[model samples]
Target: MSVTPEAAARLRAYLAYFRDLGVHEFYRWSEPAAQALEPAAAVEAPAPSIAAATGVLPPATPPVVAPPLEIDDRELQPAHMLPPSLREPPAPALRSFDDLVPLPATTIPAADRPAALKVIQDEIGDCTRCPLAYGGRRKIVFADGDPNTELMFIGEGPGADEDAQGLPFVGKAGQLLNNMINAMGLKREQVYIANIVKCRPPANRTPEYVEASTCSQFLIKQIDVVQPKVIVALGSTAATYLLGRKQALAGLRGSFHSARGAKVAVTYHPAFLLREPRMKGEAWKDLQMVMRELGLKPPVKQ
Candidate 1:
């Protein structure tokens, strides 16, 4: 049953009117209608939400972390951990006898005696024990001769001749000493000659105790260095210093005394003999004693 051409046209017009009123498809033109409707459907869908408009929440925040506590490796003990005795103060340091008082300028050991003599010589340059150190153009009156000689001659101090020449016993007294040494059949070089004090005393006044004390260590060091077999203490000062006595020279002389483990013979100083020439014989007798102690024969008179 085909419809007439006019009926077909009338049916097509009804279908198109139905599509315009929101009918999705009319069977006769459904394929073309679907193609046209697709574009409008795609355009009507709401756009995907924008990230900023949606108010997206941030990823969960990590929790706050506390700092690690530091630990000391050492073990802590209580105050009572140490023994009571350990808490007490340390004992005081021990001191020697010499520490109680100041020692002398020259306190050299016996082994170092020679070195000490050199030190003293270097220190006391042109020294005048009293006023002689400054009196004139004086070089230091250093003691000379063998430091280890067996016989030692001790005088009071340097004199005018000794001060000028820088050698001991250089004046008239020195000539007498030379003659005395010759009388013993020995040269001055064979023995050692020194003074109680190295420098000369002013106006040849006797040395005071302070002066003697100041120079005593040097003399002692010399004796210790020489270890002499016989020591001749020439004058009162020498005798007194060596013997530690203030006895009269008349009594102290003509006798031998043990001085620092050596035989010390006392005699009148050559200067004294110069003043009192009458005592020359006595001085000669004293020299005999010195020679006798040393086991040397007296010289024969020519």
Candidate 2:
């Protein structure tokens, strides 16, 4: 019959989060007609109605009586209150990159890789295959750097700079990535660069599951063509999609994993290292492991 002001505010915030995730429908949880509340408590402290509380229209069906719940407005837990359809679903088991499809019996020739990649890009032309296409992305930030390089770097997705330039790793993070590349005794032009998702997510937030899964097909093709000796996954998202498994960056890092015939190494993203400078040393260790695998020596100082 009534919701407290504090409870109403919490509900509004929770509903806003769900709405951003594209969950627009909701059902109001109310008591049955048989268990009417006393008039005195209802009148003494009237608050917002259920529909007003969540900013959603009440269901057309008559309110069905559910068992009474004693919820604390201070620490609102609305998921249980929402219907099963509206509740956040459990994370599904992600299919690994190798599992997506069998590797081609033969690799594309180095001379034809650029053309082959172009074909994949052409296939993805003016793509609306995912929600990111309509999310104000200026351009699809596709793969960059040498197509025949022995090494590759895959990041989460484009940011403002990459979105604007239509190239991956072209921002402050990109600058730092260039520095990392130089430190690895390689020029930026000598290795490939790409992302798990080609488009910049709104507000640069991590791409949602649908967005990432939808965009992964192109990335898988890119990796298959490049056939890099080693791939440096620039963050957990990159690692997750490339390896086709969801695990902590800590567990995924410090070891080599294989995907599409490339040895994968997980590390912190340049953007993350910029935020937590202390982690630079740890990231360097991960890179060193890659350098060892690639037989690469750090560039000597002048």
The candidate maximizing TM-score is 2
TM-score of each: 0.58, 0.73
- Alpha-carbon local distance difference test for all models: 0.69, 0.86
* Distance from true location, Cα of 270 in model 2, Å: 0.4
Reference-based lDDT, residue 232, model 2: 93
In candidate 2 the C-alpha lDDT for residue 43 amounts to: 43
Off by over 4 Å in 2: 1-89
Tell me how far candidate 1 lies from the true structure as C-alpha RMSD in angstroms. Answer: 41.2
lDDT, candidate 1, residue 224? 61
